[model samples]
Target: MTEIIDYGRFADRLAAPRPRWDLLREFQDEWGYTVPAGVDPWPKWSESEHHAYVRALHEEWTGEEEDPFQGVDRTLPVPKALDEWWDLPFNSFTYSPRLYWTNPEYPLTLRPDPSGYGVSEGLPEPNPFVEPGGDLRLCCFMAEYEYCNEWAYLASEAGHDDPRVLASVGEDGWVLQARSISEFFVLLAAVRLPSHFGWSVQLGDDDFPDGPPVRERIEAAYRPMGFQNWRELGADTALFGGPDVIVRHDTGMADFAVEISGRSRDALAATARTLGWTWDEDLVEPPRKDEESQ
Candidate 1:
């Protein structure tokens, strides 16, 4: 079992260092979280508050009545020719891999949970895709990679029991956690490629012979596909740029999540075929519990 710590207290500890403390305070102020040198006695907003804020943003976008129970559409608009895409293994519950290009008006909103939290639930099963004896597990991000890690740490400290939030050091010197997935998706959606240009796939620690092959195969696929460079796509923000799609392949687990850029649905489908992958059309659609009840 992973060690659990109180996130509020942890944040306070982080604030003890003068520089780190100032950084934490800035982060909290900028992001709207409360922070101090020590644990504050005040009660933080309940899960409902978090959920409600997300829901309100969604309602504003969709121009529909706010419903706390529904998910938010976090998809971003992208160019048509680039055909940027990502794929998720159907089995992984951590995230849905089959995002595609849609109408510009379709604003992506994240769905809120019962407590109004924006985080997705953990997968029902542990990942089996990481190679049995492999020491490293890699998760790449197109944007806000650091924040994703911070969020994972926060969730773990908050007494959440999800394995994805657990910090596990892999034998290959990689630290495995969950928040990377969400940040990667957000990065892909926000990247803006130059006209007729696409982004490249890059993974850290390419020194291993086993790693390059995967990168090569993905790169080879992109060359003929008419995708452009990532910089041309207007990834000026810290939370943007890098690979248009991020995939986490684990040898230990049989499951993975695919996050794609919202470029063009047809292009995304074509790219998936090149990689010998397929996506479920039904899963591509957003979740709707109300429709199922009827």
Candidate 2:
């Protein structure tokens, strides 16, 4: 019979170099796994308790000497599956990106381009809610893997109620919603315009010039709706190739195609105007007709 170790306490002690080594030996004996000597076991540890332990150890090493882990139990009940769960990083092994199909014939695919970069493909036909000849595409900006998962879950749940909302799961395990220019703008505004909500935005490849006019328009549109500071919420990643404007907030991020046009363009512009947005000719584009027949 295996003796159950108090995981919480084990995690606390496992932060120290000496304790960490001893814990590894204990694991090796208890679970029959080889722990390489001299490795920083903290980084490999998965539980929140382990993270706390590592953080404590770091503080001690830095002479901070704050026992942040004080009052935390040194041991807690270890799940029988603990070894299995710890075998690999939790996020690495379990995170799945999938597009649940409302229409089975239109299965999505993850295709790598010539450069070996992969993107989600197989978008279904445009939603009729979008005016004819309108452009429909969505660009999702994700920094953390977990956020991507959240987006996927939200989108999947939304799609069940709204067939107009289509999603494709990317190789990176993100659900990229296939949305019309209008739908994308609406969703963007919905998330950004709300006062308590947090999100970020960037210009997509389809956006041009990416100048102040566009930025001003977005800011004005989102401000009255209660959007926080656009600049501070924006991401600094090269993904947007340095968007003319970036909006960052607490929960999610978006890449805006400011210059794209479709029947929904007027609706998008209207929404912006309603939010007090002002834009120049360069920041606007004539709406295009659906070229599906062409």
Candidate 3:
């Protein structure tokens, strides 16, 4: 497996190596699960955990412990680049990227996402970018929305070794989401990790009406990760990092939207205080003393 690019500091929070990975390899040795490459994406679950996870899923649908990947056919040659993206593990159960890894052959084995767009509707097909009647194959990797799945992210099924990323915005048609699958993954991480992990605040144009002054304040509070590709917004998307979290500033179609996050309450408080944003959420709340905790 090749080293995953940070992609302007987007992927490090999601795909960076962790000390827990060593313990995961030990579990694989004990359970006979394939010990993934050192550089491969981290496993979302342990072998035993996955077995139970699969069983629960089967019980939900089949009321039986049937193998989902049974008799699956691999008609399309899976690209090495895509395989790497597929191997990376991330939380998907709720409004996140819940990856599908089963058999019974999901068509060309590319609809690895549970989105209705890929499995049920197959709405964006044959590649609209290609000339009419020209051959085009797409691999839908993920679909997400605030609630139901209404968007799709796909790539070329049989083209470029590391396919460029595409997105289907319901009826909005397809747009170039990223230059490569790796960049797409990091972009997803950059947006998702901040809101999901530390204490976060989402700001609007009012807060970031001016650019340089706001950026200078943020830069003073955190280290810069770098800008990433988010063409959907039609502007630059930059990310910054504190000791353990990320702050993303998006200047796109909707104008400026900045999210500041930190690993701990103290850190988040410090950041929010420095920015003079004391809205009195956990970000600014000091930890209670032991006696106050009761």
Candidate 4:
């Protein structure tokens, strides 16, 4: 059986510095959770503000005349430290076909917190994709990307026997990252809060120093295909051979070129063609004169 890690004890772990992934995995295994794929760095807001915003959303979604949070104790049973964290923006794993409810007449009125990535749940209609449970409701959403945005939520079952769950609704319900909303913030922060907090993923050890130097290559080869940050697309695939290191684009564009560098044209070309991308024969720098002389 997976051992249950006490929430307070986990907070102690977060009090220390360490790799985000390591801490996240530890939490997941101990708490029986998993997070979404990508990260969104939203800004922070006060707890009252968050609750107010969500209540407003519920009002908007249901077109209700009454206040949703009025006289209602929709409080979560989590550590006081975690509760305090709800003020920060929502930083969650990515979701596809980004979901956002825009009010053209008053879009800015219900705008996300200062970081511009806060998610608020107000819709009375439950997401059909998510299985019906104890008062499952949308919490907030990440920035929109690839036609959709990832959203987080709270369920009644959350914090009961199960840890508070903050999940995203996709084709498949991603319940893996379910933890008290406080835990969600703590996990992300423990790893490393994004500089933009609500705009991007935090940089782990692998992203720094010299891990996958695919960004420059992507700009050179696949920028036209709407390729942007490495975190957004994650690592597609890495090829090692003539070009030394070749990175493929995961930008969902068929014509994106394979990144290339090195003098081995024939080998690189063969590999590119086999992989179904047009090859850049000129990618290889000319062999150095000293090497040529050898």
The model with the greatest lDDT is 3
For each candidate in turn, the TM-score is: 0.23, 0.20, 0.49, 0.28
Off by over 4 Å in 3: 1-75, 88-137, 145-159, 170-172, 207-238, 251-256, 282-294
Candidate 1 Cα misplacement greater than 4 A, ranges: 1-44, 47-216, 219-248, 252-254, 257-262, 276-294
lDDT (C-alpha, whole model) for all candidates: 0.27, 0.28, 0.45, 0.32
Report the CA-based lDDT of candidate 2 relative to the real structure. Answer: 0.28
Tens-digit lDDT track of model 3 for 1-294: 122222234334334444322332332222122322333333422222333455587679977665433322245554455554444342221112222222111233233333222332333455556665543445644444221222223333444665666654444555667655555555554554445444566676466443456667776766555334444434446777655456666665435466766555555666666766646553332322222211
Determine the backbone clash count of candidate 2: 13
lDDT, residue 155, candidate 3: 31
Candidate ranking under lDDT, highest first, comes to: 3, 4, 2, 1
- The RMSD of every model to the true structure, in order and in angstroms, is 19.9, 25.3, 10.4, 16.3
Candidate 2 residues lying further than 4 Å off, grouped into runs, are: 1-254, 257-269, 289-293
Best by TM-score: 3
Worst 10 residues of 3 by lDDT: 97-106
Answer with 3 or 4, whichever has the higher lDDT.
3
Show model 4 residue runs off by greater than 4 Å. Answer: 1-81, 86-154, 157-162, 178-183, 190-294
Clash counts for all predictions = 40, 13, 4, 26
Cα lDDT tens digits, model 1, 131-236, are: 4443222211111221111112222222222123222222221223333233222223323111112212222223223423543445454322111211211121
**Local lDDT at 185 for model 3:** 51
Residues 183-245, model 4: lDDT tens digits: 443433322221111111111222223434444534333322111112212223222222222
Report residue 247 deviation for candidate 4 (angstroms): 15
